[model samples]
Target chain A: MQIRPLYDRVIVKRIEAQRTTASGIVIPDSAAEKPEQGEIVAVGSGRLLQDGTLRPLQLEVGDRVLFGKYAGQTVKVDGEELLVMREEDVMGVLEADAGTTRKAA
Target chain B: MQIRPLYDRVIVKRIEAQRTTASGIVIPDSAAEKPEQGEIVAVGSGRLLQDGTLRPLQLEVGDRVLFGKYAGQTVKVDGEELLVMREEDVMGVLEADAGTTRKAA
Candidate 1:
């Protein structure tokens, strides 16, 4: 089963915290109030204008993005936890470095 | 000097509450927590889509609308207090009765 967001909403899967210091000290997920990073899994068609016109969303699926820590709603879809939020809630996209391929597990 | 809101923002002047009961009891402005009514004074061109397209606003000048009590920010323009909010914050337009003229004072 798959989920589709409606009207500029997007489904995102959060990237788990897995960072370590030069000394190999791993940082905990609940350590800071910084923005959370996620990968867009699904995207809505667009926003519905008052005149019935549809304005397409700017973000696309597979895009890495940053969002507020408390943004969007968490829902369990197909037994997998995902976040649903409007495109406006996304801060910006994260560009991957050259030759680096990071795929969600 | 008139203020022009940017993007989908709108400037509105609140309609003072001055309703009277059938028994001639004047209801004070602080009576209820109902939605506030206001008249649109100015509107932005439209929302800026991700692709740089501008979506025109559904509202227009002189439109009577209902909004939340704390929906928008209040500012003093030319010494007259006004509200500035995005078009999305407006709940809906209030249509005037047939042959009835209600203008903000």
Candidate 2:
């Protein structure tokens, strides 16, 4: 049972936060806010425009993305929790191995 | 004090829901969910891509749009509540008049 999003939508798996803080103190699950980071799993083809052309999305699979705390809907797919949101919900994508320098696409 | 969102962001004013239901029952504000419909008040310049090119946004000012329940950040601007979100948070745009015909640009 594969789930595919419709036009411009994306499916993402949340990246769990590190259990310990920088100070090496364990942050309890109850006190921590939901993680706002995720990795793209699947994406829609594109939105169909008024002129009958598809406007391609900016996000791609495997991109590590940051989103707002309240962005997207949570759904249980195959017993795993996942988020489904539009490409615009993504604030930015983290670059690979660069420390910083995020790209908002 | 003008509020302009940076790159691919948008400012939206929520469209208030009708106070009365179809059965002429008046609904109280406490029981109503925040309206998901909005009108584009302002838009940001296109996002800067990795190749240093601007990818223009699909949303435009004056267009009516739909969004998810927790799409954007709410801010007070000139005593009015406004939502600031990226263009991707917009699900679709409602066409003007003629009954129905939404364009998802």
Candidate 3:
């Protein structure tokens, strides 16, 4: 079953932190409390205003974004872990160059 | 000097939790982590939608409301402590009957 977020919410799949250094040193991600990176899988139409008008979200699907480590609600979708959070929880979008540098092969 | 909250933000003056019971037993409110009650001192015009529409706030000055204990930023306005927070941080408005029961002299 597919889950669609409502009203300015978005679905995100976290990109796991790199576990190894370039010099071949293995580092653990669990100990550090840091911002998390994710790719937007789905986005709501927009924010619901009091006047009933929908304000479109600045984010779009497939966008790479950064958010606080503790932001958003975690849900299991088809055995895959995904996050559901409001668009405001997202800090910023990652540019093409920055995102490509961190792309996992 | 009066403080006018920005869009969707409200200024609140917290009502100190009752320090004494009916039987005249004194109690401290610091230990218990609980929702706080406040009176709206000022309100913003409304939420600013992405399209630049300003949706008016539901709250008004003199309205008593409930909010989370940790919600909002504390500021000293005119030597009096006040809170500045978005309207969403408020849980609900306290009706007249309920508000009178806790009214302090």
The best candidate by TM-score is 2
Pairs of colliding residues, candidate 3: none
Indicate the docking level reached by candidate 1: incorrect
Please list the residue runs of candidate 2 whose C-alpha ends up more than 4 Å from where it truly belongs after superposition: A1-105, B21-25, B96-105
Stretches of model 3 off by over 4 angstroms after superposition: A1-47, A50-105, B21-25, B28-35, B97-105
**Lowest summed lDDT over 10 consecutive residues: which window, candidate 2 chain B?**
B96-105
Write model 2 residue lDDT over B44-68, tens digit each, in one string.
Answer: 9876666666656767799777677
The root-mean-square deviation over C-alpha atoms between each candidate and the true structure, in angstroms, is 14.2, 12.1, 13.1
Chain A vs. true chain A, TM-score per candidate?
0.77, 0.81, 0.79
DockQ of each: 0.02, 0.03, 0.02
Candidate 3 residue lDDT tens string, A43-73: 7656776565667678878899999989886
C-alpha lDDT values of all predictions: 0.73, 0.75, 0.73
Note the residue pairs that clash in candidate 1: none
In what order do the candidates fall by lDDT, top score first? 2, 1, 3
**Residues B1-105, model 3: lDDT tens digits:** 889989989999988866677899877767644337789999998888777888776677998765666879999977999999998776445552311121110
| All candidates: TM-score | 0.45, 0.49, 0.45
Q: Which candidate is the best by DockQ?
A: 2
- Top of the candidates by lDDT: 2
